[model samples]
Target: MPSELVFCHPDGGIYGLQFPMSNSISQLDISTMKELSNFVNLLSRHKNLSSIDLEFHRKGDVRAQRIINHAFSLNVQQLTIACLFKKNKKYSHDERVAFPLSLSGSKTLEHLSLRGSCGLFDEEIVLTSAQRFSSLTTLLLHSITLYDGFLSMCPNLKNLTLFSYRMTGSPVLRISHPQLSNLTLEKGECFTHTVNGGRFHVSAPELASLHFFGFCPQMFTTGDGFPCLENAHLSFHSRLECISGSYAPTIVNLLQQFRNVKHLTLSMEIIERLNSSEELISHRPCPLANLKSLTLLPEVATFVQHKHTRVIMSPEVQKYLLSSSPKATLTEVLTLI
Candidate 1:
């Protein structure tokens, strides 16, 4: 067996099986409550566990929560919990499980990732005051429904990655942190339609890097802008059917927020969208003023399809992108998927 045990759907029951414990075993991956119950005895023998990952396929189990609490009582520094129960089905408000607040009290935890169709805050568990994660510097939340005051709890957070997160009762998702240095947001179907009117407004003075993927939001503002930003990467999903007339202007306005970035990378979808708006490009100045290096990622396909085999950029598009930072070095990257 490997140092880490990944428990999925086992053919036979795990109750009578004896797991050989080694000092090198420092991580545990459990998917169900039954697996956790069987592994509970093993945790005591292996006291040096540094990471624990749990995934719930059905409902949240109190016994599983107890095991997780026990693991946190140890010196575990990293914890990842993905509640797969929220996948594909429409759950009633009462049926949703609130994230265990007890796990946030861990003193040694430096990285915590929570994902997969769970509610972070609800009526039962309201975050009235700050529940500080003093040692937490990195947090990744995906496919979660979050409220506004949640991020205020992590005071010393430096890196935050949010993928497919939905906000509750708020159209504007505000992220303002003094110690934050890197930020990433991957858009999802929840924020695709304009009817939702969802947007992001970030204010991170110390932020140095930013990565945004998928469709452009209705409005993306960086309070006064990131004064310390150095690198930025934007990869837009190619969904031309959803692309409206306002898409180009939205991209242009969003780019202006990162004018001071030294290194920037853009995807082929973005280049194509910008290229189609020649009249707009001719009127407005290039958004990046202090750019040092520009990297273009051209779309590529797998060996099965022989369609896109090369990077293509018209001279007009190149001139439009480098109008402000003419001296910046340009590089093209291609990846076969």
Candidate 2:
């Protein structure tokens, strides 16, 4: 019979793998479970092992915890969990799988990728029992729900990607890094509630690139500690019937935050829609003097502007930047409009 798990090496040794599910957990006979347990033990003892990938199919937290414990018991550097269960109208019954908090014991772990369920935000995963992942540097978490404390504990992480299934308040994040870089958010995760607990939430700094699902005029801010982000790729959906002028303050405040940003990319996707060059370019805002690159969907470039006025960089701002760092700052200036 073919094995459910197999590891091969052409050189024929240093190691190889074959394992059976724990106990009689497999769909097959009991003998294989014993064989599988032995293989898992061999894998745990293998010194060269640096990573493990797990599939949680039972939709039960108990089994998931056992498998994760096996991986953590090893000095694994990376772990990836593919969660096959999804939450639908059935609700509570489907959320029994292991939450993100249950897998925190891998002290040497450097990278982690998670999917399936609303695990990260599960209320049962208590933070007090969680151990600090001293060496973790990268994390990718996708869920139907996520909250502030998810990142509050992972202090050493450098690169991170977060995706949420539905819209929710922007969970505050406080990051500390000496040489960290990339950051990304997908879908509804980009929208944040600035007035959470009556205080504005901030994101990580030293981030080089930021990508979101839609354009958020509220994302830009004048807050004293906001990141002077360098590159941004923002997406947008067509505005249908919004309360006219209802978004003015949010829009203004958002753009003001990008005062120090340099490169901006805006994307607007339309289904079976045709737009003219003028209509597209008109909405694009005037480029800042410090901006080195600008990209826009045709409608935004045509419509996003200071009413009928031209979108041009101010001469004073350009001269000031050129005087400070001509080689790095003044060498490239692009006007998309």
Best candidate according to TM-score = 1
Query: Can you write out model 1's per-residue Cα lDDT over 1-337, one digit (the tens) per residue?
Result: 4245554433211111112353243334455667667677766666666777765554444654575466666656777775554322454565544443344366778888876653433312222233467788999988766667778777778999988766665677888888899999876444533432257888898999999876656677777788789999987655543245467777777777777889999887677777777677676677678999999886522123345434466666677678789899999787635
Over 50-153, each residue of candidate 2 has an lDDT whose tens digit, in order, gives 66666544334344455556777777677776554444444575344333435556678898786655453342221223456778889887663444455655
TM agreement with the true structure for every prediction: 0.70, 0.59
Clashes per candidate (backbone, < 3 Å): 0, 20
TM-score of 1: 0.70
lDDT of each: 0.66, 0.46
Model 1: residues with Cα > 4 Å off, grouped in runs? 1-49, 69-75, 86-103, 117-130, 191-197, 240-242, 276-284, 298-317, 332-336
